[model samples]
Target: MTLVNNPSRTARAGVPRQARAGRPPRLSGRRLAPYLFILPAVVLFAVFKLYPIGWSFVLSLFKTVGGVDTFVGGENYSRLLQDPLFWTALKNTAIILVVQVPVMLALATGLAVAFDSTLLKGRSVFRLGFFLPMVTGLVAYGIVFSVLLNEEHGLVNWALSLVGVDHVPWLTDPLWAKVSLGIALTWHYTGYNAVILLARLQTIPRELYDAASVDGAGAWGAFRHVTLPGLRPAILLTTVLSTIGTLQIFDEPYVLTRGGPDNATLTIGVYLYQNAFVFFDFGYASAIAYALAVLIGILGLIQFRVLGDKK
Candidate 1:
């Protein structure tokens, strides 16, 4: 056989023949490469995001003492349902969310439009002035504001007095406390949000504005028809982010008023901190934290829905 067989025939004879499959599988080398590149990110997410979420969920369900946990099922959640402080926190948070977020977003939109239009001279300086408060520490700002809004000796009261106005107990009064915090928070973050929306605003085509102008659209008309629509996504994003931030507000209330006068500024975050850190009821705190997370998540979903419906 060795002497008689041709080269191809001899090679075929030496190899073991198997049953033929339908087709040889195609290896998606290019399609698969992206997944391989993203594997590190996936791993990190599993380790950090997923793992922590699981731990928090577990923590929310159990009572812990000296590092040992006793499973209590839905007890934590039930307790939250019955808690009046939780409702008060919810109401305060809701008020801030309703008022502060929209006002801040509106102001930010206006500032962004102004900055983007080149109407404002010394744009960099204006932006810096607006953004400076954001870089200032929250606790530091809270402390500063506490002093500035002090009922008796504060600059704000003195300034009001100069205009023949009465003293406002900004920290001690419930409504005034909300107002003061809202003002401070708005001042601190509106610029940051504006900068974000401004970046988005820049991405909108200048040609659209030019075309609108050609069609006899004035500034307001162009803005309403083109600029506003263009800003919907940015608006939705900022709204969701601001809602979450407001809902979980803590440091400002904590440092400025400590959830006074009589828990007027008692936000969910403050309440949670009080439960966990002050009273050392870790389970209840975890429950409140998770509830706030759920509330924020729901609000985000609602915003997304509204945005979609508009589309």
Candidate 2:
């Protein structure tokens, strides 16, 4: 029997050369199905996040005071720069960032290390307890903290009274109000960071610790050399996130102190909300929002510069 290859006959039989060669044809629209599945999320993010940000920037250029809405080229921004209240809010926010973030993250790291350590007992219970606070709603926690720190009757104040210390105004006094807010913020975020750091800690190779031990490196040395480097990425991410959150802090200040005691606890977020709803200066509020955004962006850049990979 003679078998001959014929191009015209093969073409009529409807098979491509690539198929005959045991190779598939070039991928087309079907290959893009995965992207297509995620298209809705991209569209939602553009609509909810990107569009609102762009609109807010445009709104910042307009003055909406009383019932009139008129474009006011950089006037609102100029006023923002000159506003002492803005400066106070900014200073308060800066203080929170500097003091609270490191303390919160350090606590979270300690919790993560203990939870991840073999010597630690009841790890599951402690891990759950660390993470439990995060499961509480922000507003609920804020209100709860307000009561727990009440000057005359709060559990904290009562305990202090039992120790012969006079009642400390946790919310009324300026410094105490800031301290109260810092404590609230730390409680709100530490558990979340601990969970993230614990995940990262678990990823670190146990052999590294063993090798360090063989080299006569103690726990502190192992932590300094092995653990820290492993957790850098997670730490940087949480630091940037904490910075942004502090810069935009509002709820605890608003709910706990109402940015009160002579605006001592005022934050950029609370101030922005005050302008928009209380004062009805939407334009000025927009400017504040944008300014906070810029601050957050700058701080994030600084963190990345300081902590990011060298190469």
Candidate 3:
């Protein structure tokens, strides 16, 4: 009888009451902790991002005047189609996107590749100099560039005179105004692209380079065969980002030219701002904003498809 009693005691001690077969394990503390930590960030994102997007979409369907709203379905979009200024802005943005992104990416890629070379000296200084324009405040830099590009007495013309080139009307002429904006944007962001490409370059395995060298591959051959493939993803990323940035270009044009010289520098973003803040057409502006989002999404998809095909 004592043995039987002791056996029951041993069995009871072998397993706790909580681990009995009839009940499932409790997850109240363990599973809830992670979600509790992330709840604040989720709330903030919903408040800031999703809320604004929804509000913008709703506003786009209405005609707002003096803080009063009236539902006017699709009228704002119809105005966009009819407006010559909107078309002009779209044309200008397309021109810049076509011309500037390629040039900037090419230059940045060259700079990144050059900087990555072991043959180069003073790499750090060159990198720093290239990145300086980006660090300068946007408005301040725009103001200074406007001064520098002044037609009559600016530093650019002054330097041009030394080389027997005549003064160019950078801000006044439509063609020159667009070119000046492209130059300023390229100058400001090339270093940023270089830094991005350079980081990607570092990840490329050195063994590939060594193997290429052993097989009598010159620098160009190695880069073409190895580096180019390695850099494709980064190139796609920078291209897409630069395209978006150029499409939304406002500050440089706003501060430097105010979309002047016959609205040659006007982008979709500036056009939207002109409608909303300048003309006090909030509904139209909201429509313009949504249109831009759609444009970006479509273009981004095209880019992704093309890049995917190439890969």
Runs of candidate 1 with Cα error greater than 4 angstroms are 1-49, 64-68, 309-311
Clashing pairs in 2: none
Every candidate's lDDT = 0.89, 0.92, 0.91
Clashing pairs in 3: none
TM-scores of all candidate predictions against the true structure: 0.84, 0.88, 0.88
- Strongest candidate by lDDT: 2
- For candidate 3, lDDT tens digit of each residue in 1-311? 35445776778786756666667656678889999999999999999999999998888999976678999999998999999999999999999999988999999999999999888999999999999898999899999999999999799999999999999999999999999999999999999999999999999999999999999999899999999889988998998999888878889999989998889898898999999899888889999999998999899999888765463
TM-score of 1: 0.84
Runs of candidate 2 with Cα error greater than 4 angstroms are 1-36
Candidate 2, after superposition: displacement of residue 262 in Å? Answer: 1.1
Q: RMSD of model 2, in Å?
A: 4.3
Per-residue lDDT of 1-311 in model 2, one digit per residue for the tens?
99999988878578766787899976679888888999999999999999998988888899865677899989999998899999999999999999999999999999899999889989999988878888898889999999999997899999998889999999999999999999999988998999999999999999999999999999999999999999999999899888988888888899999998899999999999999999988889989998888888998999999999878
lDDT comparison, 2 vs 3, better candidate: 2
